[model samples]
Target: MVTGDLLMAARAGDGESFRALVEPHRRELHVHCYRMLGSVQDAEDMVQETLMAAWRGFDGYAGRASVRSWLYRIATNRCLNALRDGARRPRAGATFGVTPPPPTRLVEPNSLQPYPDSLLDGVPDIAPGPEARVERREAISLAFVTATQSLPPRQRAVLVLRDVLGFRAAEVAEMLDTTEESVTSALKRARSRMPRERPARARGTEELALAAAFADAMERGDVPAMVALLTDDAWLTMPPAPQEYQGRQVIGEFMRVVAFRDGARRYRLIATSANGQPAFAAYGFDRGDPVGHPRGVLVLTIEGDRISVITRFENSAMSCFGLPGTLEGSDHRDGV
Candidate 1:
C-alpha cells in the first residue's frame, strides 16, 4: 500500500500498518537522532520518544505532505525537546570541572544495535550522491560529530537536517518550524564554528587503502609503520567510554606498549560506517587458530590519506562489524 493509505490505517488504530510505515525509516532516523544528540544513549531514548509520539498522534498527521516528512517533523521535535530539557553533559576536556580519565582498552563498547548499511539498499541513496563534494563525507566523521557536540542544540538540529541528511532549506523550515532564511543563517554559523578541517591531504581512496594497510601493519605489530599511517595528531576514542587520547606521541605509545605492543595479532574488516564516515570492524586475535577467537573491533577514521583516529572498541562490535574471530595473521581470505 502507498504511505498515505498506510497512514490512514495507522490513524484507524492499526498498529501493524503504523509499524510497517515506520520500520523502513527506523535505522536512518536513529542515525539522524544520533547526529542530533551526540550521546548514543540519548539518541536511543529520543528515537523511542519519537516513535511513541508518532503513534499517539497518527490521527493528527495531515496528508498534505509525505508521511516521511511528517515523521521527521515528529522526530526532530522530539530531539529538540530533549535538548531543551538540558539533560546533556558538556564535553569534559575544556568546559567541565574535572576531566575524566581516558578510555581504556578494557572497556566495553556501547551495547547499541548496529544499523546495517543495507538500509540504503532499497531506499534511494539520499546520502551525498557519490558525485557530490568531498567534504560531504568529511563532515560526517566521528571527530566532526564530536566537534558538533559544541553547538547549541537547535543549530545542531538544523545543520544535521540540512547538511548531513541533505534536506532542502524549505523542507528543514517545515521540520523546524522556522523560516528558510533563519535556517540558512544558522547553517552558516554552524559551518563557521565547526571544527577546522585540514584540506583532505591524502588522495585516491585513501581511507580504504589506509584501512587495508593499517590492518596489515597492526597484524605485523610494526608500531612504527602503523604510526606512519596515522596523522601526526591522530587519536583513538571509544564512545560510551569518554577517554580520548590525542597526538601521535601518546596514542602511538599506547598502541605499541599496551594494546598491540606485545602480541602477534591478526585482523579483518567487517565493512561498516560510523558517525556517517567510512568505518570497519577490524577483528583481532592472537593466533591463526579459530579457537582463541575474535578479539577487538577497531573503528577507523581517515583524514587526508592518513588515519586520523582508530577506536579499538571492546566486545561484539567485532561480530557486529561482521568480522570473524581472527588469527594474528589471517582473515579467512573473506573479502569485505
Candidate 2:
C-alpha cells in the first residue's frame, strides 16, 4: 500500500501498482496545476504530463526526495515551463447554465465577465479526509485563487506549498529549487499582496437554502423576487459570449429571452465552492430527471444583504476548463 512499494513494483514493470502509487495525488496535483496554469484544462493536461514524465523517468530516481515532493517537483516545473511557453493563452469557450439577463438599454459603468461554475469553480476540493475538508474549503475559494493568479510563479508555488498544503519552508524550497530563506521571503510578500476579504461573506452552507428559494422564483420566472436577492445596479455577464448587462430590468429581460424558463422544476445544485465564494453545479430538471449543467458555473459577488454581481462561465477555452461537449462527459467538476 505504500508509495515506495508501488514505485518498486512499477520499476519491476507493474504499471497498475505505479498508477496506484500516484492515483491519490492526482486530484490535488490538478489543483496545483490550476494554481500554476490558471486554466482548468491546462492544469489537467499538465497533471497528465507530470505523471507520464514520472513514469518514463523512473530510472532517474535516486530516492533523494519523498514521492509526494517528487511529484510536486515535476508538476511545478511543468507548469512553470507552460507559463514560459507562451503558446498557451487562456481560452474563453467556457459556458454557463445560468446567466444574468442583459440590459436592453444603457449598461452599468462597471461589469466583469462571469466565469462558469465549471471554469471558476473547477478547483478540485481534494481534502484527504473528513477532518480536513472544512479547512481545505476555506482555502480554495475564488477570491483566494484570483489572488494567487497575480503572484509571480515562484512565489505562487511557495505560498501554495507552504501555506495551503502545509509544507514546511525546507520542503517548499526543495520543491522550487531555492533556499528556505528565499521561500520565507516569497510567502511574506504573497501574504501582503493578498486582497482584503470582502465585507459580504459567502453564506457557506446556507447556500443550499438560498438556492432552493432562488430556484422556485426562477422556475416561476419571478423577476421581482430574483431582483430582490440582487444588489442595486447588479452586474451580469457570460464569458466567451462577449455580452454584458447591468441593472435589474435589463437583467430580467435577458433572462426571459435567453434562458429556457419554460416549466422548469426539481433544480438541484452540485453543492460546491469557488474562489472562496459559495456556488453550485446547478442541474436542471423539468419533472424530475436532470437535464443539464448548463449554467456550468456561477460566481457571485455580494455586497451585504444582496447579490451584487453574477458571472456565468461560457466554457470559452475548449481545453482549459476541462469541458467536453457537456458536464456529463468531461468538464472538471469541483470547487464550484
Candidate 3:
C-alpha cells in the first residue's frame, strides 16, 4: 500500500500497517540515536523508546511533517531527555588492565562505542536540507561522535539536527520545543566548539593500506613498524579505560609496555569497518594455543598517509560487528 494509505490504516490501529510504515525508518533512526547517545546499546534503547512513544502517540503526529521528520522529532527529544536525566551516563571506573602511562590529560572512562559500518548500509547519505556542514561520513566518524560528546546536551542536539542531519533551524527548534533563535544560537556555539580538523581519506585505498600495515605490525609485535604508521601526534585510546596516550613515542611505549607485554602471546587481526573507518577484530593466542581468543576491536582514524587515532573497544562489541568469539589457524603462515 501507499504510505498515505498505510498511515491511515496505522492511525486506525492496524498493527501490520504501523510496522510497515516504521520498519524502513528503524535503521536510520538508530543511527541518529547512536550519534546522539554515543553507545550502541544506549542508542538502541532510545530507538525502542522512540518507537513506543510514536506508537502510543500516533494520533498526535500531525500530517504537516513528513513521517521521517516526525519520527526524527520523536527520536531526538527522547535522546535529549535521556541526556538531561542522566539516564545513561558513561560507565565509570571500567579499566582494561594496569595503567600504561600518564595520559595527555585527565580523561574519564569514555562510554562511547563504535558503530559498525555494516549497520550503515542502505542508510540515506544526503542531508535532508541545505544547512548541513558535516558530510554524511564525517558525521558518523568516531572522531566526530566523540567531539559531540563534549558539547552540552542541547547544543549537541541542535548541532546534530541543524548541521549533521540538515534539519532546518525551525524544524530543530520544534523538535527541541525551543525557538528558532535558540537552535541557531546553540548550533553556532556547537559548531565553534567542534574540532576544526576532520579526519581524512575514509574507506579509501590509502586508509585500507594503513589499516593493513598496522594490523601486521600488531600481529608481529613490531612496535617501530606500528609507530611509523601513526601520525607524530597520534592518539591511542581504549574506552572504558581512563588512559589516553598521545604522540608516536608515547603510543609506542604504551604498546611495548602494555599491549605487547607477553612476548609469547600472538595476535590475529580480522579486518572490518566501523564508523566509516578501518577496524579489526583483534584476537590473541596464548603461548601454545592454536585458537585465538577475542581480545578487542581496534578502530583506526586516518589522515593523509598516517593514522591519527587508534580507539580500542572491548570484545563485548564483537558480536555487534558479526565477528566471531574465537578464530582458528594461529600459524600466521599467511599474514592478514
Worst 10 residues of 1 by lDDT: 91-100
Pairs with backbone N, CA or C atoms under 3 Å apart (clashes), candidate 3: none
User: lDDT for each of the candidates?
Assistant: 0.64, 0.61, 0.84
User: Which of the two candidates, 2 or 3, achieves a greater TM-score against the reference?
Assistant: 3
Q: Write the per-residue lDDT of candidate 1 for residues 217-262, one digit (tens) a residue.
A: 7656677888888788887775545556777777766675456534
Per-candidate TM equals 0.70, 0.67, 0.94
The C-alpha stretches of model 2 lying farther than 4 A from their native spots are: 1-4, 92-134, 198-205, 232-296, 301-309, 315-336
Q: Which pairs of residues have clashing backbones in candidate 1?
A: 102-243, 103-243, 201-304, 202-304, 266-328, 294-325
Decide which is better by TM-score, 1 or 2.
1
Q: Model 3, 231-328: lDDT tens per residue?
A: 98998988877778899999888777677664767788988889988999898887788888988889998988989899989887888888877888
Each candidate structure's count of clashing pairs? 6, 32, 0
Query: Which stretches of model 1 miss by more than 4 angstroms?
Result: 1-7, 16-21, 39-45, 84-123, 127-136, 166-174, 177-185, 196-198, 201-206, 240-243, 261-296, 314-336
Model 2, range 197-296, lDDT digits (tens) per residue?
5455546456545554554555455767767787669877654345667888777766655554534433333444455554444544444443344455
